[model samples]
Target: MKHINLLLLLIVTTITIVLLWQGAQTREKESQLLEVISRHSKASDPSKSSDLTRNSAPGGAARPSAAAFEPDHFLTELNSLLDSAGTDSRTVQRAMRMFLFDNKGKLASASPKALKEACNKIEADWATDAKSFVWLELVSEIVKSDPAWAIRNIDRFLMTIAKEQPMEKMLHYLGKNGRLGDPAWSPEYAAELEKWFDTAEADGRLKGMDEEAAGMRFDLNISLGNLLGAVEQLTHLPEDSLSTRLEDLAASSSAPSGQRGLVEAVAAAVPATDFQDFTRALSQHAGFDSARELLARAELTAERHDLAAAGIAAADIGPQTAARADWLITTLRDKDAGAVTGFAAAWTQAAHKDTAAWLTSLPAGDARDAAVAGFAPAIARLDGATAAKWGLTLENPSLRTSVMDHVYREWHQQEPEAAAEYFGR
Candidate 1:
């Protein structure tokens, strides 16, 4: 009987040890499960209670399961929790990004109307979250399939949102990738876009916009490359306001010389009869020096176009027939000295006298020297004796030498013996 009792005690001890081991194992598993639940709860809802530890399982189930951790369901629950009252903007945005990432494939495959509805829901839910850009993210996705709808709603979104962040984002997207010039643009859509710009400008939002946005607006609307569109926009602005804005735009250091394009576009848009007045205003607003440069470029472009169409030689084009007096002077100064001289001599006698007077009256500078050199060869070819007398009046020694060399070459070419005899003196 004692032996039997000993065996029974051994069996009882074995059973006790087994029960303890299993209990420890179950406790360890519970600890691990609680860790994961704690992490997920904190991530999805920071305000969740420490009492969750008593439940011993995640998702309020008897045990953790694969379904409890599915990313889509997890994100959906997290989003629902985040949408609750008192949730901060940072948390909402984080949750929104996660939701988007998890559902991106499904969203991409959805119909445009469905995609738009999802975006509207996000906007409605997060409208109070000042720092949230989830709506923009949604719009970006929506734009890939339905750009027109996205664009039409952008202004509406801007109107509903208090912050400039959304507007800036929309502008940035529009400016990037030539979205403004999208081939899908319709007349109604174009009008809507124009109206938006008008409102933005009137509200001073355009003025306060970032430099890139401002540049894109001007580039899309008022650039000379888009002459018709540019002119239409310009005509809508008051004259004084337009002049002021143009001056400011022209002063940008990034494109100082490029302002000439703006000037030319404006000039082309206006009636020819009003061009003088327009130029005068431009000179007053942009400064005389800048105005002159712009006008010169404009005249050069027009003349070149005219010449090309008329099949006229540039060399044969005379100052008298040119649109601007300065064009002729500039052309003469640019040509080779010999050509200039020949052209001056070949001019009508009245023109030759006018050219001579103009050259003499020029201030003593490289320009004056170039003009003197240009006229010397022609004068010598026409009458070497007279050119020799005029050579004495040259102030720069190098210029004087250049004039004499040209005169000698021309005179030699025309009458070698007489040129030799004249130089021999």
Candidate 2:
């Protein structure tokens, strides 16, 4: 029993000694870490060292010694702390926070070189497992002081850990609607940004930023007065939101120095392919009367004339859409009644089934009859027998006879016997 008790006592003594040694090591490590942080804090503000020295002089208040701001020395100690084994995340985060941010999480006025070096070191060592919020915040702050440098370096930070917050911040800083007190946006700057967006999109950093990119492009084109380009961007946006943006354009365009009357002018100037987008948006955004007024006031070349008529025809034909169509047919009948034929051709070329459905939905009367009259000619161009049969379905007897007679005359010119036989039947 005596031997067993002694053996137990020995075991306890060994364990106690080991624990004391470990406690002492922990305290020593903690002390070293605190000293490093103290030095870093002092370096962030060089005035602290001067204040200490001044206070230590004659007739000065007594003060503690402060280490001078030494980028090289401080970095060495910082790297050493990070290199030590068993360093926890809390320790690393606290250390980096002290090095990069003040009490309010704002960046300190550290030299750019030191800031960059320290950030690079932290990102290299500590960012292997997770993205660093502290690092991203630092970049956001940097964007204010040197946007160009931030813009150039941001992609590097995002290579492995792409983040949307910082990317958007960088873009917003350069966009025209930037925060108040920013430098006025210049067209040259916009042009440069256009190139950057193009490359960033190609590289995939701009993935999922379609709406934002479109908005920026719209603003850039506005600054450059590329009306067609600006209007083109609107097509990518939500249909419901187009009215407000169009209103913005109209408000500005009403000014004497604004692009007033140019909307109509550009309609005739640009190619049909380009002007189609403008007319589509215009027809959908404005009510029927508004669309009619705008189109009526404009001087459209032949290329766009039919497209404009088609845009109205394809738009939502409520009372408003119906009114616009009637007004176009009645008002322009003497001058360009052939526009309706073109409208029918364009609509049918894309979706004949939809054209048939639209014609069916029209109220029974002159409107439906006139629309059918327009469609008959275009359909005859496709299949004259089919068009003559379609004209026979019309309710107005005289109108039906007239339309069928016209189809008969055209068909006779192509297939005389077939036309006579079909009409006779």
Candidate with maximal TM-score:
2
lDDT of 2 by residue, 171-274 (tens): 66555655311244455555656667778878787666677777777677666666556666775666555555554444334233323254555454444544
The candidate that wins on lDDT is: 2
Reference-based lDDT, each prediction: 0.51, 0.57
Residue 51 accuracy (lDDT) in model 2 = 35
List TM-score per model, in order. 0.36, 0.38
Local accuracy of candidate 1 as per-residue lDDT tens digits, 270-358: 44323333444444455544554555465434433222112111123345323332343454323222322323443323254555666
Estimate the Cα RMSD of every predicted model relative to the unseen true structure.
Answer: 21.9, 17.1
Error of 2 at 373 (Å): 7.7
lDDT of 2 at 390: 73
